[model samples]
Target: MRILVILRRVLDPAGIVAHRRLRRLFINREEYLIQPGDHSALEAALRIKDLGGAEVVVVSGQPEPDDDTVCRGLAMGADGAIYLSGEGFAGADDGVAARLLQAVVDRLGGADLVLVGMTTLDTAQAQLGPRLAGALGWPQIVGAWSVEIVDGRVRAVRRDGDDYVVVETDLPAVVTVPGRALEPRYPDGARLVNVYRGEGGMGEAVLRWDVADLLHPEGLVPLLENRGRDFPPERELGVRVEGTTEEVAQAVAEALRARLRGA
Candidate 1:
């Protein structure tokens, strides 16, 4: 079985500060980490590979020259990794990414299962998995808490309202794991060292493909546009009301009613 996992890099939230009043974001330190949700997806893929006979492959979720994300996956026990790079792909949007990933799957001769993050941390956009599924015309199970393969099908648990529900899909399906659903194991020390230093065939396992080879000019055009940023109104100081218990309660009710009316 061939399992494909998509990985993305995100700026660590702890290294940045959001200035709401200034409507500007400040970065004290620029540090990148694997997207949390995607990390869980990788863990799910590794677990499946450990139990059943499967080859795990990692692919870049975006266009980046750096292969850090894929190399990290290799250290975590992935069989192979593919890096999608080139100038044309620099600012590609989700639609373009989905199309590119579909092409990669085809180039890989298809896969038995595909895994991706339910959402990205910075953008909080849960569109990649569904978009890729749509592009491939495959069944998708999103926001999975846990996943396993049984009877030639992929079984996953997802939260439905207040309870967890089991959902199953046939093989060759897409699954998006939720963030922090499963703890990701630490990478092997030797493998981690080799992958980062490009030694011991680890560097050879990570293949790079030019975006131009997979997409045309029309396909490279982004479907979304950034128009600028918007900031919320500044917070105001609280008002004080003095009176007995009943009087205070009545004052609060009246204040709420007035605010509602104004809204």
Candidate 2:
């Protein structure tokens, strides 16, 4: 069985500062880190590989010439990596990415499973996995905490409201893992250095793919465009109801009723 894991890079939040008073964000240092959710997904994939025998491949759409994210996946025990690049993908949105990824899956001769992050760190957008699932017409299990393969089926532990439940789907399904679901293992030190130096047989593990060859220019056109950033207004402090229990309950009920009426 072959499992494909999607990885992405995000700006390090520790290197940036957000000012509510000025309503602006400042980047003190330009550094990138693997998306937290994607990191967890990678860990999940690696765990699955450890359980049995499965080829794990990592794929990324980050710009070329900088294969840091994909290479890191290689050092973290992925069997192979695919780096996607092209001018048309510069401003590609989730919709365009979904199409591109769909093509990648087909070009790979298909995979038994596809694992990815439940949401992106920077945008907090949870559309990619669902969009890809829709594009591929595959069943998706979102926000998986644990994953396992049993009898040609994929089983995962997921949260339902405040409860946890086990859900299973057939092979060739999509699974989105939450950021805090698992702890990511450190990359192999020697492999990490070797991958960057193009030595120790790690150089050939990365394959560069041009998006143009995968899809037409028209197909690369993004469905969404970034206009600008909008910051929320200053937050107002909440009212405090310090009284007897019944009085506090009454106050809370009145507040909710008022809010509902206003809505």
Candidate 3:
């Protein structure tokens, strides 16, 4: 079976967002951190690769598909990488982005399953995953925590509201993996460092995709815009002390009861 994993560039979530103080900075925004969903997708995709039965392919959005990026994906365990890069598609928003990605799928067209991160690092709206699936007319199992391939069918575990979910689907399906669903193996440094130096290396690895390549009109729709933001001052925290173990328990119970009564 062939599995295609869609990797994306994301801002690290642990980092704090900074105020855009420099006008010349490249794409600076107040929300500078990558969302958690992107990490989840990468981790999940990597897990599928490590399991060993399928050939894993990685795809990304860039103006030109880079050999270095492909090497990195290989280091992370992908068999190969596909970059859907170009000029007109550079500023495409999520909807437009989906159109571009769908074209990549059509162009690269041979896969039993396609896995994507739940959301991109920059945009946490979690829109692209499902949209891409819809555009491709594929069955999608969103927010899967775990997936197993058996006899060309997929058995996936997912989150459903407060409950968990498990579903079985046939091949040629698109599944959006949830955040940190599984651990992504560390890059194989020794092997990756040598992939480029090795014989017959990404000989001429590059794909130049233009918006005109797609069946859709070359229209760029803005996925997001900042109308405004509200800054709420941090609320002051307070602490209360209860006399003894018994007294503290009593106080907590009384407070809870009183709050519930009011509600």
Candidate 4:
């Protein structure tokens, strides 16, 4: 079986500070990590590869530097990695990304399965997987908690109200996993060193493809545009109720009622 996993990079929120008073975000350290949702998706792909002996190919979900996320995927037991980059790919939105990925699927001669994160950490946009599924004309299971392949179909567990329900789809389908649903294994020390240093016949496993080659001029247009950022109003100090017990209780109840009504 041929399985494709999509990966993305995100800035570490701990390394940044948001100043509401100043209405600005400051980056103390510019460190990047794999998107948490995509990390879980990678773990799912690795588990499938381990059980069924499938070829796991990791691909970048957006245009980025090849050295970070791609190398990490290699060290995490992916059979191959592909970095998609080009001038045309810059600032491409979810719609353009999905179209470009569909072209990649065609260039790779199709795949048996595709896995991606249900939502992005930074933007919280969940359109990529669904859009890609529509472009490929394949079935999709979104917000999956767990996934497995049985017989000739893909079985996934997802939340429905308070219960977890099993959903099934045919082969050549897309599955989007929720963040932190599965714990990702640590990368192998030797493999990590080799992949970073480009040694042990593994250097050729990571390939770079240009977005211009995969997409047309019309397909490169982004659907979303960036408006200016908005900041919430600053917080105010809490009011203190000073009186006898009955009076304080009455004030508290009235405050609660007012807050609920406002809500």
The reply for model 4, stretches above 4 Å from the true place, is 61-64, 241-263
lDDT of 4 by residue, 29-141 (tens): 99988988888999999998888788999998456554789889989999999889887787888899889889989999999899999999988999989999999999999
Per-model TM-score, in order, reads: 0.90, 0.89, 0.72, 0.92
List candidate 1 stretches off by more than 4 Å. Answer: 61-64, 241-263
Residue pairs of candidate 4 with colliding backbone atoms: none
Looking at model 1, residue 196 earns an lDDT score of 96
lDDT of 4 at 249: 99
- Write out the backbone clash pairs for model 3: 11-34, 40-179, 40-180
Error of 2 at 175 (Å): 0.3
Question: Which is better, 2 or 3, measured by TM-score?
Answer: 2
Kindly indicate the candidate among 1 and 3 with the higher lDDT: 1
Q: What Cα-based lDDT does every candidate model obtain?
A: 0.91, 0.91, 0.65, 0.89
Q: Candidate 3 residues 1-263, lDDT tens each?
A: 77777666654444544334332223344332213454455556666556755677776665444445555566665666666655655556778877777777777765778787775554456777788778888888888888877677878898878999889888788888766676565677666665666434443333434656664554555566666544444455766865999998998898889999999
Candidate 1 local Cα displacement, residue 176, angstroms: 0.6
Q: What's the count of clashing pairs in each model shown?
A: 0, 0, 3, 0
Estimate candidate 3's alpha-carbon lDDT, on a 0 to 1 scale.
Answer: 0.65
Residue pairs in steric clash, candidate 1?
none
Model 1, 201: alpha-carbon shift in Å? 1.5
Q: Across residues 106-126, which tens digit of lDDT does each residue of candidate 2 receive? A: 999999899999988899998
